[model samples]
Target: MGQPVLLSLLVLLAVAQGVVLAYWAIRDRRFRSAHRAARHLHSADTHAGRLALVGEIAGSIAHEISQPLSAILTNADAAENLLGEPDPPLDEIRRMLADIRRDDLRANDIVRHLHSLLKRRELQTTMLDLNEVAATALSLIQPVARKRLVTVRSCLDPMLPPVRGDAIHLEQVLLNLMMNAMDAMASNTANGAAERILDVTTDRYDKYSAAITVTDTGPGIAAAYRPRIFDSFFSTKQEGMGLGLAIARTIVHAHGGKIWQEGTSAGGAAFKFTIPLQAA
Candidate 1:
């Protein structure tokens, strides 16, 4: 009886081990799939693509690093001048110190965001509100548009369904498109189009997907360039290195979405990207 009981116990142990191994294999497979998608995004195979990505990464590093460093230097200069005063106001110095800290934190955030943006990471999806992401992007762009003397308006559907995507990356994608729209408008200086209106909207594209559109009051992409606008190293702007649209396309594709452009009724450019909505 004792021998029989021991054999049964051993068999049960083997079954448990098989279950554990099977579970890990399934999880690893999923991870590998996601990792492969991430790898394709950053992988530079073609010569032209690599060159464009390198230039983009360099310029982005410079832009991200310089802003906060400039702010820190400006604050330091102000603090130094304040220190030279016979009656140095502690309150003022304290404010400067706080600002320096804030800017330093901002620089750190930029570094982190860029790292996440460029690094190969698995796409972690969650049910995310598209309107909220659009709203946040608009709030951030409003100040930038104001500085450029452009107006940004939004008409987001409050009842829009949630999509499965990484929220941070979605926001980045939205901002990228809006920035392109703004740049398109900025280039309109030659066209004498004074009305620079950037209209952003979100609505249901279909029963299974939702769309976000950014329309700009500027000359739309030429027929020739429209085909290659999202291609690597394709740029309309003189200073553009042409990585933004490529990156945007990759992100949207990875999320099982599609992005495209067209000429809007307002005689300007419009870009619309759609993502699959999560099932109820």
Candidate 2:
């Protein structure tokens, strides 16, 4: 009887030891997995940051170069006009020279804007007119829209309150969204002859947020793909690398704002983003 009791006690001790070992193994595995996941996330975020930096640099270079190129074109046009006439008109030549100067200044302003965007600096938060940002973005994208024969419309609330944000980044976000909308419509070129339209609007929300929406008259996103539309590498276009919306969302979120998509009343797609208004 004593031997049997000792044997039973030993068996119980062995089982308890096994349980403790199993628990430790499971806990260690979970820790390692979590650690690896965190590292991967950090690496992905770093990669995105690097890509954004490169984009800003390239954009600035283009903007700076474009200014000089624009001035050259204007001068060429002016010279052509002077040569076309039987006798060159002094007043017309003077007007053309004035236009060249004006365009050069315009180009200078573009370079300044690009420089501000590419500068590695902290966010200079200030009260910003959302309408001005919207207009800036629209102006930048207007040429692209015209090339595609797309009609661009704007409905801005003139009395809207100001929101706090980095103007450059916010403008970039809006530009990306508008470009994506254009691309979405471009993909359906084979379906039929369709007129493309992009409607942009700014409104004051009752929830104390300022909203900007970009709506496209394109084939709406499928139901199954809606939830994952913002995911990295998820794209509907055959040639798309799918970083636009993801980057836009990141920028918006960094500004303490939100971005989302919905089906528009125009029977197309609409993407709306919001920034909180500065407190009075």
lDDT of 2 by residue, 1-280 (tens): 6999999999999999999999999999999999888656644553454346436345544654586677769786877879799999878777777777777776776666656655554445688999999997787677567666778999999999999987866777787788778887885563465558899999986667899999998888889999988888788888777776776787678678899999976567999999889873
Give the TM-scores of the predictions, in the order they appear: 0.61, 0.68
lDDT of each: 0.78, 0.77
**Model 1, 224: alpha-carbon shift in Å?**
1.0
Angstrom error at residue 19, model 2: 30
Q: Check candidate 2 and list the clashing pairs.
A: none
Write model 1 residue lDDT over 1-280, tens digit each, in one string. 6999999999999999999999999999999998886575454322233233334345545665687899999999999999999999989999999999999987786566545545544457899899987875565455567667787888999999889997656766787787778777775663474588889999999998999999988878889888899988789898887777887788789799999998877789889999999983
Off by over 4 Å in 1: 1-121, 189-193
Worst 10 residues of 2 by lDDT: 42-51
- Relative to the unseen true structure, what is the C-alpha lDDT of residue 171 in candidate 1, on a scale of 0 to 100? 68
- Report the error of model 2 at residue 260, Å: 0.9
